[model samples]
Every structure is written in C-alpha cells, then in structure tokens.
Target: MGHRHKNKKLGILIFLVVCVLFLHYCTIHDVVLRHAIYRMLFFLPLVLGSFWFGLKGAIFVSISIIIPYIPYVYHQWNGFYQEFDKFLEAGLFVFMGCLLGYLSEKQQREQEARLKAERLAAIGSAVSQIAHDLKSPLMAIGGFTKQVTRHLSIDHPDRKKLDLVISETFRMEAMVKEMLDFGRPFQLQKTEENLNHLAAECIEISLPFAKSSGVDINTEFDPEITVRPLDSNRMKQVILNLLTNAIQASSSGKIVSVRTKREKQGVALDISDCGCGIKAEDQQKIFEPFFSSKKEGTGLGLAIVKKIVELHGGHIILFSNPEGGVTFSIKLP
Candidate 1:
C-alpha cells in the first residue's frame, strides 16, 4: 500500500511539472497560439487529476495551472476584454476540475458499494445451502443421543458420555440455526410491546448462566416507557445474544449492566459488560458475519442482532475501552 501511494504521488508530481512546462511554452508563443492552446491544454490536467486523485488533486492542479497564467496576463496586458477573457478561462478551469472531480469520486463510491452488496448476497446464498445440508443430520444425531441418555440412569457409566454427546449436538444445532438466520432475510412480526417488560424477562432467563459464571447483572430502566410496535421475539433474541456474549466475555465477579430509557423520539437500550474489552481491529468487524474473535464463536450473533435492528427501522451504537468496558446501545423508532 505504501509503495502504491508513493507511486501515485510521484505520478501527480510529474503531471504537475508537465502542466507547468506547457503553460510556459504557451506564454512564450504567439498570442493566437497561446489563447488557443491554453483553452485546450490547461483543461487536460484538471480533468485527469480529478479522475485520478479526486477533488483535492484536481483543485491543486487547477491552482497550479492558474498561477503560471498570472504573469502571462500581466505581461500581455492588452485590454479589459483580454484580461476578462483570461480570468473567465481560469474560472472555467477551476469549475470543471471541482465538478468533474466530485462526480468521479461519487460514482466510484457508488460502484464500490454496489459490488460489496453483490458479494454479500452471494455469500448469503452459499451459507444458506451449507447450513440447510447440515441441519437434518445434526438433528438426527442429537435426537438419538437424547433417547439413549434417557434410557440410561444418571449414575450409569455410559450416561455421562451420552449426555456429552447430547450437549455438544445441541450446541452444533444452535450454531447451524444461527447460520441459517444470518443467510435469510430478516422478517419481523411486529406488535405493540412493553420494552421494559421484555428486557426484564430476558434478564431473568439469563440469570442461571450469570450465576454459574459468577457475573452479576445490573439493570436500570426508565419507569415511563411508552409501549411501541416491535417484534417481541426478535428483540428478545437480540437481548439474549448480547447478554450471553457479555457474560462469556467477562470473568467471575465482573458486573454486566443493562439499561433502557425513553428518548424523546424513540426508545434506547444499552448493555454494558466489564470485560477486557474488544481490540481495536476486532471492534470494526464485530457485526460482520463469520468474523469472530472468540475461539468458539460462530460470529453470527451480533450480525443477526444488527440485521434484526435494521429490519425494525432502528440503529445500534457501540463503545468500548479497556478501562471502561464495552457497551452496545440500540435505538428504535
């Protein structure tokens, strides 16, 4: 990357030098040739720079093209008509540079976004197939293990092995489900639901896991929350995934705080955990599917949460620091 940047900068410098030489030649030639060539040659660098290096480069080259013309205009101070014509030409050069540069940059961005969307769509299709193929066999294995475990007493020698098989199989099934969820379109069943009540319910459901991990859950909710239309089940899934992550990230004796508030325009939910905090690089890709920092993570939890939030016309904000921990804030309209 550094080599490419250096090469690009060198190319721009060479182009600037070439523009200066052209302007000098025009100034020293006949007035007719000077005016004709200036009208044509000066614009080449402006358009080229704009197309290559965008707005800043285009503006710089435009200024460089204009500076050399100043002395030429003063040297041949013919009349007001001549001077005005020269100034107008300069203005047109700058205008074209800015306009073309901006349009070129915008078009490039739009193209990049389109390509990214296409790639993600392809990935989703592939994941859907793979997850579907694995689900049926996984369910069968889990079912057989469960039946065998039920037949054996808890104290039987083989019961523990069967129980482990069942446990691992369920974990695998959950992972597969998450993959399917990620690869499918997020559909919400919306209803008018109490935000506070749903949050409390999820917290209670996670209590056993929190106790086993020796983490305490602290919650602060606004008393005057207005019931709003949302998908209660999907929202609960978001809460569960985040809470599970927080608890798993933190060590024993750490505290996880879940907070809810009624914003002026919408409702806000935040979950904070006192973990070691996410690394700088990891934070950027936290919501990207299949990008997980955890050894056992499938990397679809936060991705699915983000999809569900967007499906409901909401947004999520995240903050993290080693000293202060990580907080995920979800806002809904």
Candidate 2:
C-alpha cells in the first residue's frame, strides 16, 4: 500500500513538472493568449495535488508552478499593468490550492471516521454473538472438569492432567469474558476516588502473579495527587490488566513498577516494566482490537483499557522505556 502511494505521488509530480515546463517553453504565435491558456491549465495539477495529498501537496505544487512562472514573467515583461495582472493570477493559484486542499482534507477525515464507526459496529455485533455462543459450553466444561478433579484423589496419576484441563478451561472462559466486555457499550459509574489508593490496590492484586512469574512489583505514589471522579471497578480492571501485562512481559527477577503522579490535566497512572520492549512497528496498533504480539493473547485487554479510560474523559499513552520494556500511562482529566 505504501509503495503504491509513493508511485502515485511520483506520477502526479512528473505530470505537474511536465505541465509547468510546457507552459514556460512551448513555442506559439500570440504569446499573451497562449500563456493565458496554459496558465489556466496550471489549475489541473493544483486540484489534483490538493485532492491526493492535502494542504502540503497543494502548497508545494503551487510554489513549484509560481517559481518557473516568475522567470517566464520577467522574460515576457510587457508593461507594469501586465506584470501586476500576472502576479495577481499567481496569487489566485495559491489561494485556490489552499481552499481546495482544506476542503479535501476535511472530507477525507470525515470519511475515515465514518468508515471506522461502521467497522467497529460490525465487529461488536459479531463478537457479541460468538461470545454468547461460547459462554454456556465453557461454563459447562469448566464445571465438569472441576467436579471430576474433586472426585479424584490428590495423588492420583491423572490428577495433574485434570488440573491442567481445569486451568485451560478457566483461561478460555476468561477470554470469552474479555470478548463480552469489549462488545458491550461502556457506562461509567463515576465517583471521586484516590488515585494513589487505587494504584496500590491494583499492585496488590497483581502481586501474586508477579511472584509466581519471578518478577518484582514496585510502586511510587505522589503524595500531592488527589482524588478524582473515576469508575472505580472499570479503573481497577484497566490497572490490573496493564499490571498483569507488564509482569508477564518482564523477565525473572525483573521489576514492574506502578506509579501515580499529579499532572496538569489531572493525574497519571503509569505501569512500566524492565523487560524486552514492544517493537516500534507494533506500537501504533497495540491498542487495536484483535491485534496482539503474544501467542496466546486475545488482544482485547488494551483495547478495553483504552475504551474505559476514554469513557472517563481520559486517554492512554504508551512510551518505550530507555533502558528496556514499555510504559503505559493513563492520563485522566
């Protein structure tokens, strides 16, 4: 796609250069009428550039046209009135380009936004149906596995195998729950809550996982950070999800840190890890639904986190740590 776009731009540029050269160099009788006809032709490239590449393209093409025309105008210096008229026409070319470019860019943005909305609607509907279908069977399988595991003696040869089955069943159930949560619309139940306390609680909840993974969890809460309106449960989910991901990404004996700090907007909750960081190419798509770097990830965790944060009038930012790993910052307003 990128290569195709580059090629298209090159073609347009070549065409524009050809048009400019023709206007300046073409030999014909009746110079004034000929120049007028070809000058009007400059608008074709201006319109094309504006529609294809927005303001920058329009401005660039207009400047390119004007530069060559300036030399031609000097060579064809007839009178003061003629020179003034020519310069006015050049100014009009730039003005037309700017206007067309602005309108084109606005149209493109509106179209993109509309398409994104339609795609998300379709995905939500499909995910809701699939999650609903899988929910009951997953529950049944998990229940039966648990019952069978209970019937078996602890030292039985198949006990460990049954436990593994139970574990996998639970994992699938969790994935299903993630899908359902993502498909549903967000309705934030907001109340004023301490950011520091919330971060501490999420860190505590993630402690067990961190320990089992041989990773250490750390926290730094700013004393000056105050309470703010938040959907406590949803916020907990966001924090826990981010913390768990950080812990999982970290190596043994590595540290995953959670911090809360006061910011100009409101407060920021940051989760940073000392593990291999995300690839630069994948960073932009990290929060996109069903886009994951993990082999077993459902890829909905970050998407849901972003949704919940935005619902509360906040935004999430991801940064690559200098030493290692990635930092996810939830900034609230």
Candidate 3:
C-alpha cells in the first residue's frame, strides 16, 4: 500500500513539474512562440489530469500552469482593463478544468457502479444456493445440541463442553443468516421514519455490550432532521451492524460516536470508533465476504451494510487512520 501511494505521488509530482517547465519556457520565449493557440495548449494537460486524477487534480494543474502564464500576459498589455481581461481568461481556464474534471469523475463512477452490479449479480446466485444447502444441517445440529444440554445436568462432566458446542452452533446459525441476507435480492419496504430514532434504538441495543467492554457510545443527531422515507427494518440493521463492529473494534474506555445529519444530497450517517485501525491493504478487502481480520469474524457485516446502502441509492465511504481510528459514513438519498 505504501509503495503504491508513493508511486502515485511521484507520478503526480512528475506531471506537475513537466507542465510547469513547459509554461515557463513558453513565457520566456513569448516573442517567438506567443500565438493564441500556444497559450491555449495548457488545456491539454488540464484535461488529461482531470481524466487521470479527478476534479481536484485538474484544478491544481490548472492553477500551477496559470501562475507561470500570468506574468507573460501582464507584460503583453499595459491597460488596466487588459489585465482584468487576462484574469478573466484565466478564470475561463479554471472553469473548463472544473467542468471537464467533474464529467470525467461522473463517468468513472458510473462505470464502476456497472461493474459492481454485475459482480454482485453473479455472486448472489451462488451464495443463495450455498446458504440454502447449509441451513438445514446447521439447524439440525443446533437442535440436537439443545436437546442434549436439556438432558445433561449442570454439574455433568460434559455439560460445559456441550454448552460450548451449542454456542458455536448458534454462531454458525448467525453466519448462515448473514449469508442469506447478502445473497438474496433486497427490496426496501420504505416508510417515513426518523433516522435519529432508528439510531437511538440501535444504540440502546448495543449499549449493554459496549458497557461490558468499558467502551463509551455517543450520539449526535441533527435536531432539525425530521422523519424521512426509508426502509425502517433494513436501515436499523445497518445501524446495528455498524455499531456492533465499532464496539468490537474499540478497547476499554475508547469512544464510539454515531451521528446523523441532513445534507444537500441526502441524509448521512457516520459511525466512528477510536480503535485499532484497519491496515491500508485490508481496508479495500473489508467489504469482500469471508475476508476477515478477526479470528472468528464472518466479515459479512460491512458487506451487507454496503449492499443495503447501494440498494437505497446511497454510498458508503470509509476513512481509515491506522494511528487514530476509522469512520464509516453512509449517505442515503
């Protein structure tokens, strides 16, 4: 991950350096190469940067090129309005960069969404079949273990081991449920519900476990937010899974903060925890089923969360800090 990041930074630096050098050369040689077409050549790199790095990259490269070209433009004309016209020309360049960069980003995102939908469609079928096949056997095992425990006295020699077996079976059952949940087609039964109230319910459910581990749970819901149409049950599941993961990630006395806010685009829910943060490489794989960092983790929690968010025409963003903590923000429209 470090190597990849370093390489990306190097590439951006090299691009900016080359662009700056070209602009400087043009400025110094303006007498021989000062055609209007020559001044407009800067847009080539600006467009390329946007396609390569997105809006901010395009704007940054535009500003870098404009700085060198400004002095040349100033030396060409002495009138006050002429200087203002040059600034307007520079502003046009900036606007072009922003527009092209935004379109390129939007296109890239659409392509990614198409690819993700295809992948999910392929995987969901196989997972559904597998979960269906495994469910019956797991239920049988759980039933047998419970019956055995009922027969055995609490002081029986095998009682503790049998109890452990029952617990393990229950855990397996939960995993199976998650598999089915992720594999099946989800249809949101939307109704008007307050996001803050849903969050409070999730917090209430997770509070006991948090307190047991000496972790603190905090909430900050926007007072101005009102009831909005959403899938109450599924949204609640998303909140609970996030809260549970945060609680599990933190150590004693660490704080987990959950917040909901109204944004111009939609509603946003942020779940953050001061815990042992995720590694850079692992962060990308966290949403892949069965890719877990924990000894007994199912790794389906976040995957399910992501699927649900996407189903609702929303997106999830992960901000991971290895030294500090991680935050998962879900935006629902």
Q: How far off is model 1, as Cα RMSD? A: 3.5
TM-score of each: 0.82, 0.88, 0.70
lDDT of 3 by residue, 163-270 (tens): 898898888888889989988988899999988999999899999999999999988999887887889999999999989888988999899999999999988999
Cα lDDT for residue 161, candidate 2: 92
Runs off by more than 4 Å, candidate 2: 25-30, 75-88
Model 1 TM-score, all chains together: 0.82
Report every candidate's CA lDDT. Answer: 0.85, 0.87, 0.83
Candidate 3's displacement at residue 148, Å, is: 1.7
Clashing pairs in 3: none
lDDT value, candidate 1, whole model: 0.85
After best superposition, candidate 3 residue 147: deviation in angstroms?
Answer: 1.2
After TM-score superposition, the amount by which residue 98's alpha carbon in candidate 2 deviates from its true location, in angstroms, is 2.9
For candidate 2, give the lDDT of residue 266: 86
> Would you give me the overall lDDT of model 2?
0.87
Prediction RMSDs, each to the true structure? 3.5, 2.7, 5.3
Order the candidates by lDDT, highest first — what do you get? 2, 1, 3
Q: Which run of 10 residues does model 2 get worst, by summed lDDT?
A: 23-32
Residues 107-155, model 2: lDDT tens digits: 9999998998788788978998999999999899889988888898989
Which whole-number lDDT from 0 to 100 does residue 114 have in model 1?
100
